[model samples]
Target chain A: MSEERTEINSLGEFGLIELLTKNIEIQQASTILGVGDDAAVIDHFGRQTVISTDMLVEGIHFDLMYTPLKHLGYKSVVVNLSDIYAMNATPTQITMSIAFSNRFSVDALNEFYEGVYAACEKYGVDLIGGDTTSSQKGFVISVTAIGEVAPDKFVKRSTAEKGDLLCVSGDLGAAYLGLTLLEREKQIYLESPQLQPDLENQTYIIGRQLKPEARRDIIEFLQEQDIQPTAMMDVSDGLSSEILHICKQSNLGVVLYEEKIPIANETKEMALKFSLDPTAAALSGGEDYELLFTMKQADYDKIVLSEQISVIGYMTDISEGAHILTKGGNKFKLVAQGWNAFQQ
Target chain B: MSEERTEINSLGEFGLIELLTKNIEIQQASTILGVGDDAAVIDHFGRQTVISTDMLVEGIHFDLMYTPLKHLGYKSVVVNLSDIYAMNATPTQITMSIAFSNRFSVDALNEFYEGVYAACEKYGVDLIGGDTTSSQKGFVISVTAIGEVAPDKFVKRSTAEKGDLLCVSGDLGAAYLGLTLLEREKQIYLESPQLQPDLENQTYIIGRQLKPEARRDIIEFLQEQDIQPTAMMDVSDGLSSEILHICKQSNLGVVLYEEKIPIANETKEMALKFSLDPTAAALSGGEDYELLFTMKQADYDKIVLSEQISVIGYMTDISEGAHILTKGGNKFKLVAQGWNAFQQ
Candidate 1:
């Protein structure tokens, strides 16, 4: 009680991390890199090592009212694996740690792990080690994934370049819209228990929110095409926030085309039904888990035709500012309003 | 409720992990090892990789009634670094994730991270990445530690040979005794609200329980002496259980000396006060976080003697059985009563 207490909000998450790590001394000669990338890179046994971790808590990250445990398990793995892919590394191993309240019967945990197993199998990642303990309340899952890449082959978010072609894989904003639909349905169901909800047409958008996939295939495709992204990151915090990250880190600006933005047909339809703008959803909706990267124009011919890949925007000098070319060809300044769990 | 339900208890933790990992395929050639050992081993550009993870849940692992948030933070990192040291690797990078209930004020979290920062500075590890989110109840901390070692220098638990000398670093059972004392005090305080429990003389044991240190120093000492352990593991799950792990994995048996089992004077006194046997406490009491290992007998002369390192036993042929030689010259079988959190 004698110790002075300080508010975590004062330090924030990033500030706390920096304060904790500021005095750490790297003593190992083999620790080529540590604590500063999408993944912790270790130089060991002549290979470049990559490690990443993510944790998700119930209510904070998901609501079980509409979220299935199986999808939650799959998404947990996908989110963590996304960090490995962000480093341009191939994930090979993962350790899952979970804490569950007694309210969850043993059967529920089995169902959760079933989905986790499916994800591991689908991604070709080994479920290596983990710990399970009793939580005081709702379920919590933490996954740490280890990956590998050629020493020089790994891409970092800090390497974005001026005039690089900014690209994104697959469509975006569906997950956010999907989440909104689920929340509204839950509210309506609560108000009138006997009302039958309409969900047949919203499956595609809902599926994106409930079960997201890491862009591991995109990593493989890039390798096959012999093209390396100059800088890359996963679109977990929306396109606007992710682009801002690259721009800030790479010291450049970006120009995105609103008309060229890839929004799935289902997503657009749902946006209209909800009276929401597809562009707004694409810009601000999070948890897409898609890849956003920058590459040289020369390599465009190799990847442009790929079905899973999309060219959403390009990078420019810092003075150019981040702009979205509207469908009418007018320039609009881009802004980032990504989800920050800490912000009230 | 209509979904088919299966129980997780039927498949235990290890079984569940096995089931989940059965179909996983490693896609990266640089991943030298995964899903086993203390941490996943990746082949980096220059050195060998080491990684390990540990999860601590409130109520199951610790009681916030007597546990300071700062100590909990420090202990979490120590538990993880201990595993890295068990592999004879250098602790370098760590990612920490936590879930806290709203009952915990933001000030409490800042205090917790301050302790984490202190330990990070003491251990020379960087806080690279992590996630923080709201917990429905209680607190959960998950830490993943990454270290590095030379390919040839990395120690494993499956290499002990016959006649190998079994060694342990530091005294044992103090942490367990500390828990017993704290529990008694807690019960007493619960019975009488006005009671003030005296713990002036219990500092050593209580500190062991509250702030356990990882044996990274032993690793440095061994390297300085150029003595490589044939087999090694951290004594996190009691001395007997850890020894059994090495024996089972290495296909060997052990003959332990009762008198050689190191116990601190304070720990012995506390056990006697609590009407418990000190030696028994040292054998099966968990959470000591000390190093227990075996080395070839011929290498003993190369390593200098230190008070911290005690020769407790010798490995023998599997047929010999794991036996403890008492001062009375009677042989007794060793049993591992390892802690299982899932058990009632």
Candidate 2:
């Protein structure tokens, strides 16, 4: 490095990626798109190839004190699958690379792979290749998932039209509440070694947080419904943040209904128990791993209202603000305050 | 995760990977091969696709005390590229991800990517996609490289025959000696904070360790020579270890002569300085990133007398012990004591 030093926070994660990669130009004819999108696309044989990656860091992403290695492994695969799902494609293969501190016993790693295997089995995705290395500190996982879809069916976040219905897969905020419960129990156990976690009533919330499933089923459901989403992305960073991404990319605004936002009863109770607003958790709390997509209103009724998919809002002209209408009919502008690991 | 506790050491790295993934069955028809080769192959459209991954962790892989961030980033990508080269494929795309502790400044990461960008430019590879996450420990890099080769051109480690010539790319042991010099200087600096390293004379060796290059050039040169290697692997884990992999897989043996082994002059001098056997370092040193391959004897005249490729030995039937003809004219069984991060 030069004698001059600059803090990482001076240029946030996205800013750093842009600065470092500004000179990068795609050289391969196979690389149809690079560096920007829900995933990279390589034109293969005849169909389009989709590739996406995600990395999970210990301590920053999870507290292994309460997070099981199996769930961590499973979640690592699911998060990448979620990115593939965001592109409206089914993941066929994934490569996982793990960096582990020796503090973790070999058995711990076995258990971790056991969970990865389980997710692979459930999703019908192949565990193709990976690297195993030793970290100087906590655990780290990076997975690159590859999938294929017809070039026409692939959804990009830059194509939402005005008046398109903003649909979401399943409920949100449950995972965030689950994490809060786990953290609380971890602290309680830390203070009193013999204290057992009273997690009897929070199974749904805790399960959502620990072993959240990717919305692969939604992809199949959309296929059956014959509705191609105009714009789509995974709700890993809360609905508000994802909505802003779609709006910013597609150059549109949205109007969301607070009453229409999906939140399970279990999540609401957990939020109340923690003395937190359920809506706030659903809006800004992340890691839901649900599909947030937009489709033309003409196809709304075609998507049979099931427990899994819900219509929460609709896209609007750019002049209209991206706002949330409360149950009391008051509108508030939406702004993103989602997780930013580089902020500190 | 059950009440049972098992040791991962009992399984070893490969064994652990096998046991954990034994139950995973590929369900996607596009996935042609998985988990058993240097890279995974997926049938896309009409073309066969290849993907490989590798991860590097600080302390276990490199000591940042003497290593520069730029070189670390470059080596991380080079290491992954070696896997592609091992398969006799040319890498065209890469996804680079990093997890770093707050100790790393934005400028430091920029320098790191500067190295990565340099390698990409040198190799004609594209940076397609990646993830950025926060690590609570030292820096970690995980790279996934995708490449394409005519299905028939790809080589495996299990294809060498009895009469094939064993060829290695460039020289060996230089990287191993380079690491020794860097470690010695690091200890000196630790003892006396103001001590500047006497690094002028050790640049070649130290540079090999700090900024090793993958022999992608050899792949291109071999193609030009019209000599396809029967079996090949990158010498990341020492010549003895890699040769053993081919022997165990192809059921063959090899006879190597110490006098014929290539060692750089600087490396030999550094070995004597450290009171280490230069030949021993050449035999077992890891991270040289040289290609160890076997070719048909008919192609001997084409590869020999070339400055870039060296004919080191020849393959034999399995009954013949894999032996090394020492400078003293005594044949000794080759020992495999390759680098092991866990044991470190």
The TM-scores of all predictions, comma-separated, are: 0.88, 0.94
Interface RMSD of 1: 3.2
Best by TM-score: 2
lDDT of 2 at A142: 90
lDDT of 2 by residue, B76-177 (tens): 889888888988988989999888888988878888998998888888899999977788888888899998877678888889999899889988999999
**How well does candidate 2 reproduce the true complex, by DockQ?**
0.73
**List of chain B TM-scores, one per candidate:** 0.93, 0.93
Tell me how far the alpha carbon of residue A181 in candidate 2 is from the true structure, in angstroms, after superposition.
1.1
> Which segments of candidate 2 are over 4 A away from where they belong?
A1-5, A338-344, B1-12, B22-24, B338-344
lDDT of 2 at A227: 90
Cα lDDT for residue A99, candidate 2: 82
